[model samples]
Target chain A: NAGVTQTPKFRVLKTGQSMTLLCAQDMNHEYMYWYRQDPGMGLRLIHYSVGEGTTAKGEVPDGYNVSRLKKQNFLLGLESAAPSQTSVYFCASSPRGGVGQPQHFGDGTRLSIL
Target chain B: GESVGLHLPTLSVQEGDNSIINCAYSNSASDYFIWYKQESGKGPQFIIDIRSNMDKRQGQRVTVLLNKTVKHLSLQIAATQPGDSAVYFCAENGASGGSNYKLTFGKGTLLTVNP
Candidate 1:
């Protein structure tokens, strides 16, 4: 089973460009999250959803928007991509809405804004 | 004596040797802790976990130890192999009386096993 799937494994964009990152899960998890990873830094939470039709801001939420229209899908949108936002993006899902639960992650999407 | 944080951000060991990676958390209320390993260009994979009550938990070749007194966590790999080389992360599970729980991760330590 595809535990977690992230679309556009790799992408490139120019400054001010917009893009969307899609995360899908087949485990029927109740919680989903979006995080960014940079060199020498731990994965920082960007946005998350407790359940379908809900979204919440994370530690790093600026310049990012998220939507959870369906239980199986969570989308992260970048309205205006910047060079600083060109880090690897990861999508994760967990059985519960708590951090104590083990989260399954996608391979990750490599994005670069020049 | 208590350690304020991780002593080493990188570790190297000869193949077949035991390796230990350390992590320190800042929260006292965190009850759940997890260890994750990430290889090059991949997602972080769960290795093991321990709760506040438990001091240790083992999974296959990996073991996780949590010392709540110091808010410290550690991962021990026995008979380290080349495949064990990767970045290791420790996460604390916490909730601020909210429905959504979030994991806070520390700066990962890079482990290298040399033959």
Candidate 2:
């Protein structure tokens, strides 16, 4: 069904390199989010989008950026990759915003910074 | 800025045995709670959810119990199978101000099922 899809499943970059991770959902969801998971830690919110043209900062929004130009597509970018930024990035979507809604997640992208 | 956390980091169980994972949340204002299971190299999948007002909820072989008195949440699997091996996380969140949509998650507990 292609509920939520992420591209470039794995990537390795130098300390100062930059890259973009793409996420797309086919359920026509209105809310999308990006989170990073580290060892022995819970998933930390990086950035999120409420609609096609809206975005907001999350708990751990530092060192990352996100954009939602279309209803189904959400993009996460790293202006300058840091070693501390290496983690498993996950993207999720829901029918709408808020804590009451159920969120569906993509497989996730494994990013490594040298 | 409160958080949710698990008491145990890992739980090992034999096949056909029941599994119980516990979580504790620090926020009394949070009313919604959810459980997610994440396997290796994959995303977290929704297993079940419980609200603060409800004491228990069931789904398939899984059941979620919420104790508002102690701010504790637990997930019980009737008969955990090998497929049930994964990292389970409990998440809690609240909604207010017309736009605060945040879901705080716990550091997952890894469930190991022995065949």
Candidate 3:
């Protein structure tokens, strides 16, 4: 089974352009998260969803919005792409949010904003 | 904001040797810690994890050690091989008297295993 998958493995955008990144998981996880990774920087959470129809802000939620319309899908949207938004985007899901649950991640989407 | 940081940015080891990566966290109330390995063009993969109550945890070829008094954590790889070369990250999860379960990851340490 495909654990987690992200669409648009790579994308290039210009300033003020808008786009959405899609994340899907075959595992029936209850929690999903969006994170960004830059060179020499660790993964930073942008947004997360605990369940279907529920969303919450994470450490770096600015310049991004998320929607969890379905239990297996989480979408991250950039209203207006900026140069600073260029980074590798990752989607992760976990069966639960607790001490023992480890997050499973997708390959990642390399997004560059020019 | 609490932060997780690595002691060294890079490390090199020879095949058949042991490798150790260090990490330091600022949050004392953190209840859980995890170690992840990320290869080029891939996402981070979970290696091992330890809870605050436990000081050590071991996996197949990896071991995680936690020192709560110093807020320090370490990952040790046994019999390092070329395939073991990658970036390692340490993450912390804090419980602020609620159902908080957010992860704060460290910068990461690049491990190079030479044959």
Candidate 4:
């Protein structure tokens, strides 16, 4: 089974451009998250959803919006991409949001805003 | 703010040698800890995990040790091989209540195994 899949593995955009990153999972997980990874920095949470049709802000949610309309898909959107938004974006999911539950991650979408 | 950090940014070891990667977490309430291995161009894969109540846990060729007293965690790989080369990260469930599922990860340590 393909645990998690991220679409548009690589993309380049100009400043003020907009884009969406799609994350899909087949594991039927209850929790999904979006994060950004930068050089020399740890993955920072941008947004998350506890369940379908519900979303919440994370550590670094600015400039990003998320929607979980389906049980298996989570989408992250950049309304106005900036150079600083140029980073590798990762999507993850877990069966449940509880102790000892490990998150499964997708390969990631490499985005660059020039 | 509480955070997770690694002792070293990178580590190199000879093939067949044992390797140890260390991590430190500042949040005392973090009870669940996990280790992930990320190869180039791939997602982070779960290696192993341990809870605060337990001091050690092992799986396959890897072992995870958690020392709550010092807020330290470590991963031990036996007989390291070239395939073991990757960036290793330690993460903690720092959410105040149990099972929030959000984790704080360290910057990660790049481990290289030389033949």
Global lDDT of model 1: 0.87
Q: Once superposed on the true structure, which residue ranges of model 1 sit more than 4 Å away at CA?
A: B1-8
Q: If you assessed candidate 3 against the hidden native complex, which CAPRI class would it receive?
A: medium
List the global CA lDDT of all models: 0.87, 0.88, 0.90, 0.90
TM-score of each: 0.94, 0.95, 0.95, 0.96
Model number with the top lDDT: 4
Tens digits of per-residue lDDT for model 4, B9-109: 88999999999998889999887888999999988998998888899999999998888888888999999999999999989898687445889989888
Ranking by lDDT: 4, 3, 2, 1
| Candidate maximizing DockQ | 4
Compared with the true structure, what per-residue lDDT tens digits does model 3 show for residues A1-114? Answer: 889999999999999999999999999999999999987677899999999999999989999999999999999999999999999999999898879888889999999999
DockQ, cand. 1: 0.61
Error of 3 at A7 (Å): 0.9
In angstroms, give how far residue B64 of model 3 lies from its true place: 0.9
Provide all candidates' interface root-mean-square deviations: 2.7, 2.1, 1.8, 1.8
B90: Cα error in model 2, Å: 0.4
Error of 2 at B114 (Å): 0.9
Candidate 2 structure quality by residue, lDDT tens digits, A6-82: 99899999999999999999999999999999887888899989899999999899889898999999999999999
DockQ of 4: 0.68
Better of 1 and 4 by lDDT: 4
